[model samples]
Target: MPISNSSFAFLIISAFLFLSVFQTHGKVIINTNGIGQHSFADMKIDCGKECTRRCQLSSRQNLCRRACGTCCARCNCVPPGTSGNADVCPCYANMTTHGGRKKCP
Candidate 1:
């Protein structure tokens, strides 16, 4: 028995379609509960919500990190020891102060 040309073409087409579908679908495995038992196609969708919540909590005015003394000197925010006077805080290192503008120490 000899394979027909149409049958051969059909077989090739079927194989190509099968391969294209298989290659397009991908799986991502996520380990949850510290036991490696979770599988997810999109972990970021879940993790991102949690991350946003945590960031919001941390960015609260009272919860924000407060640096003072020399540490404040390096910060871009209000410089150290000048918390009472924003006018005296340094803007950037090597920058000059003019007309009450702050200069980096």
Candidate 2:
């Protein structure tokens, strides 16, 4: 049986639409724990704001601190007297110094 031109066009359009929807339905598996996933260290180097926000929302507070510290150290914001202080000291110093202080700048 000869296929009609309209039927052929319909088949092609249906196939294209199906493929487009299939692509849109793909699963995006994100590792919410941030372990064995995309490196925060790398992302922070390039995109500091996004990295900081993600770290702030992290379930593991220590991990978040570490991530923030890594970004700060890369950006040369890590303070003095910080001995492996990636977990607390830097952030504490920043908060205490600048939380509500009026800057002369």
State TM-scores per candidate. 0.27, 0.26
lDDT of 2 at 77: 40
Worst 10 residues of 2 by lDDT: 35-44
Which candidate should be chosen as best, given TM-score against the real structure? Answer: 1
lDDT (10s digit) by residue, model 1, range 1-105: 999999999999999998886566545443333433333342222322322332343444222232122223333233223223434323332344465633322
Taking all chains together, the TM-score of candidate 1 against the true structure is 0.27
Quote the positional error of residue 79 for candidate 1 in Å.
Answer: 58
Listed per candidate, the RMSD to the true structure in angstroms reads 19.6, 15.0
